[model samples]
Target: MLVGDHLGRVETEALLEMGRLDGALMYCMGAPESIYAGLALRQTLIGALRQEGHAFTETRFQAWFAGLTTLSDDPSHKARPPRAVCEAILTELTHSAWPVLARTAASLISALLAPHDLQSPDAAVELHTVNAHARAMVDALGAAALTPLPALDALHHAVAQSTVFAAVERAEPALKLVRADMRSDPHQAPRWAVEMLYGSCLQSAGALHHPIPLVGLIRPDTAGDMEPGEARIIRAATLCEIMSTQLAMLAHASRQSKRAGALDTRSTSRAPDVLALLSGFGAMRSAQIERVLKATRLGVRGMVQLLLTAGEIEQTTVSGAHLYAVRTHPSDRLGITAPLEEAFSDDAMDEYDASMAQIDRLLNNAASLQR
Candidate 1:
């Protein structure tokens, strides 16, 4: 099927008529953002049609709900990072400045959900309207260094409306099955798979108008790049990102789910496997990783950064060649690897000091020459 035009309103109505709301919602969930915007507007009209407190069974709503969530995985539409963004986040998440970052994130969310002055150059209020929760979220996020948070939060709030929430809540168990699959075999995930699956979960939560749930089962202490505690937090963020996609998909697929040949993918969640593969190989030639993951060189580099920051893996330069290795060793050992010093490793600390000293000498020499 073509990306956007493959589904339309007439087709969506037919799906609803035929009791294919799940599939329809699935298609909507996967549709493009531009299409989703129209769908959301239409949904606003539809919501006006039905009486307050009216509800339908899960099966009755799934197809229509799916249409809304189809593209919930895209980066511009949600706070959830694309694979590349994930790597960047992973790096910052572990940095000494994480507390600052976390506060920033909280501030953005709060700005979206509550009233606050944004630290913009113009000091523009985050949202134009006091009740424009979606726009507020966007404004708040736009003020921050990270750009995706606003649209993502908007998409999330959109999906949390009543009709969408019903469909996902009804199918909670099925969604949980998908979650279980990811935890059970993270190795099956391809490079972008985790983002996709997490998107699905987040959209489902939004459809239910519920706060994103914790992926407590996917603990890092058991097996993965992140530690148990970090994994939970990362997993939660990942879910938020993916749900943004699901929200978009719901609008896009609102029409396509009733049709037999629409809304198909290799799997619902493949992130775990992707992470596993990258982690297992430590560092391969950039080309090697690219070929295996079928991602761009830039994407692989981002992935490497994520692994590095999570302390799951590391890199070194030997004779002008950079190499990667999993940090299967203790954290104490890995601590020595950074530019920062580790008390136990005299060699790394000395090397780092020497490098800094050389830089200092070069700067002094340059200054003297200038004088």
Candidate 2:
């Protein structure tokens, strides 16, 4: 299991906060409700935790999980999840299968997130410590993880679309339909379609963030039924795009965990890394920045847009690809000057090379998934 220094120094209140973050991800990883659908649940857990932090433990986790069952689902009804559901969740967390699953996921996550250039004797143990937090929080989620919002029709329709971009463009509106289906089963959309839905779906703007490959994680239930036009909205290529983005953030969080403390995440959002990259590299296109830093395209675009608005970065076209660099004035405020080598250590350069190779391998694997 993901056993380690996870047992003590954790208060119930801290477990509540930690569990809310790790629990939702772990529960959805193996649940009928895919992790993508856990966005609201994730937000709910975050919103519900009004406590402070300390240590983590099984007893504390169980209490938090049970407490979620008491959270008011609506003004009239509290969400009393079933006892059987609760046990299933616990079993999934504590099961022998979890170590293997967590290791596989974390290894890839660590490789993608942490600097994979080298490993120390403590690397394996540190990895276990990373997953240990996730394991503890799994129980705090208990049975609130069962989300049966399936819409095979959406996937079918998605696959039938001509191009990936066409499918991506329309996914926003289609997912809105699937969420309503989640509430009342009113729409005839597929459940996998619901996985495409992220936070802030109903809002005028799309997800405050970019797309994740939740749609890529699970296959359509009727995949065999639509053999002819089953080309799929989530092609290996599209999955590669979404997965790249998710992997980038997961790596970002890994870096944060090291500095801020395990599960003590988001000292700041994803802005710093991008700003750091541009400040060091001088002028670079989005692709180059992503290659070096593992920041994905949509996210890079979002950050670039934000920086542009704040006048922190300026854009120029090189050949054809747009390049972004810290604005001259803002660079002064941030105390960043170009010339590259002064800004990045040799180890960091090695990390950049390793990350590029890793991304290339992942893209190659992505192509194989189409078969």
Candidate 3:
């Protein structure tokens, strides 16, 4: 299917069709700046759709929502590091910065929802709308940095003294305006941005790729590369991420309780084929893996990431062809011998290989989005 064309075939169409200026676009103090940012994000998305084929930009939203979270450690890992530098991080729903984040995210949502400004930028108002909420959040965060406040009272002081964020009437007039957006990419597509608007203005991510729920579930490829987070917060983010994908699948596929050839790989019956093939069959090419799954190239792009992320899959190239094998073979570990090629039918991928162009495209798209 053509790139964007594939989107219309899935449930995501339900959300894209819903991207209207709903009442969610409130007249907050920071709304204009947010709309400006949202327009920039939309344009960046358009470019990715044109070039990358598919994008799950939500996974790489560290920049847009960076300062909003901090890290903690996972208690289960006995060999865990010190309290200051940990693997785990916080999410929007889980962050104590929620008091400020709620307002800031709402401001961003209002910005994303609007293709234009609700009122003229130059128009006079009671409180001037500058880049207020986020700035307020930052200043407020610093002030409340040392003092511990009660749950309810914290929000009262989360905003700058001059920041005014009150309810906006639906009757307010809006005008379409355009601003120059220098750069836009998939990373700019914040995890929560799509999730917050999902089911209404946006669909679940991964129409042309593996569906990653809007959980902002990201970690470094190696050990030292880190983003801010403590242990416990990161754990919460992880739980939320995978569960988001699973729950979304369940909701969309309530009619078919069992995972099958569904759009989302994690929700599909064939999802296990990647692991099964690598584990049972040993080192093989992507074409061979696809043949075993009996699915199109797209569908076969399944649980490889899940396995690889778990450090269970070993990927390397042989004679310029990519080959995958289960790392730390289970059969060898158990002292049981695994049968060779004879166990399967006559499919020798000796001449066949797979290109990681799709994965490369995703990575490039993600890197660009970080701005």
Candidate 4:
């Protein structure tokens, strides 16, 4: 929770020296500049421990791991693993220490590499050393290698998901390109390509805060083209979307339950008020209208159904969010002449132009008097 503690001049110099050497190695390996800084810090700590020649233990490993992660915004607290302490712990690390160090470095690499897609060939190369170190640690630990810390696992999972979500968003532009290609030559757009588009759209919908069921949104044309991978993606997306929607709706309903504890408001009598409100607001969710009307859940549901049946209101879904809006009437003409009339009154405009012209002449004449 605390920010890193200050290291005295001597200790800081030593740490920086180790960091510089490690940074050079990282740069030579073509890793990102940020990763270079992180690796340098890790190397510095490891170098210090190796120099000290202290016996490494699980408890000591955990402590060191926690120290490395102690960075925070608060300036008052010292870094969790004090710089002086780390320097003191510096010694030659033993074979027993390799497993802990490998795991710890893997955790750091995971954090550093979170924003990048691990599937990329370039990313794989960037991570090769970190992965190799982790493997070596596992081998050293033999059959007794400790499981990854829960916090590290959680961080990795979140970053990985976020990367996937970003890819899904970017897929739209590519999909449009594919569509254009398919129009020119149908075979150019394979079944897998279409399925990828659908899957991305589906997953994108599910990633929303209040996701709605996307199964209904799936186009019949695309569904049949889905391969096993695409099918699995769609299935997961559908389930997640439905679950998220249900949870959001249920939470909204629960909040309304307290307000609607006493349904003194009449259903039939208040139906017109609800319709007028919807008309004025343009579009709203059921929970929003319920709160505005102070009506019971059942009452609102019944009235909404009636309005739907009467064709007075219609529902539309946009990006997994349900919205209700009043239907436009066929006879309702748009007022096209109002703006034109306001902007141009023939006589008034002529008079204004003449007055401006007179003012300009008077100003020019007054300039001669001043001279």
Worst 10 residues of 3 by lDDT: 80-89
Query: Candidate 2, after superposition: displacement of residue 244 in Å?
Result: 3.4
What RMSD value applies to candidate 3?
Answer: 24.5
Expressed as tens digits, the lDDT of each residue in 139-194 for candidate 2 is 22222332111122333344434132122222344455556434432112222222
> Which residue ranges in model 3 land beyond 4 Å of their true spot?
1-265, 329-371
Q: What is the per-residue lDDT of model 3 for residues 1-371, given as tens digits with 9 covering 90 to 100? A: 64333322222222221111111111111322222222222323322222212222321221112221111112222111111110011122123222332332233332121112223233212112222343344344344433211211232223212223221123322333433342222212112222221211111111211111122222212113233223223333343333333322222222111112122544445544454333322355556555545567665554565656666567765446555665663333322322212111233212111112343454457446753
TM-score of 4: 0.20
Candidate 4 Cα outliers beyond 4 Å, as residue runs: 1-267, 333-371
Tens digit of lDDT per residue, candidate 1, span 97-212? Answer: 22332332222221111112123222122111211342233234334433122333333333334231111212234455466435331111111112112222323333222111
Clashes of 2: 15
Total backbone collisions for each predicted model: 76, 15, 16, 15
Distance from true location, Cα of 82 in model 4, Å: 44
For all predicted structures, in order, the TM-scores are 0.17, 0.26, 0.19, 0.20
Query: In model 1, which range of ten residues has the least summed lDDT?
Result: 185-194
**Per-model C-alpha lDDT, please?**
0.30, 0.33, 0.29, 0.33
Instruction: For each candidate in turn, give its C-alpha RMSD to the true structure in angstroms.
Output: 26.6, 22.5, 24.5, 30.3
Model 1: how far residue 338 lies from native, Å = 29
lDDT for model 1 comes to 0.30
lDDT of 4 by residue, 241-321 (tens): 433332232222222222222234465455554555443223555655666566777878887776777676787663354
- The true-versus-predicted C-alpha distance at residue 128 of model 2, in Å, is 26
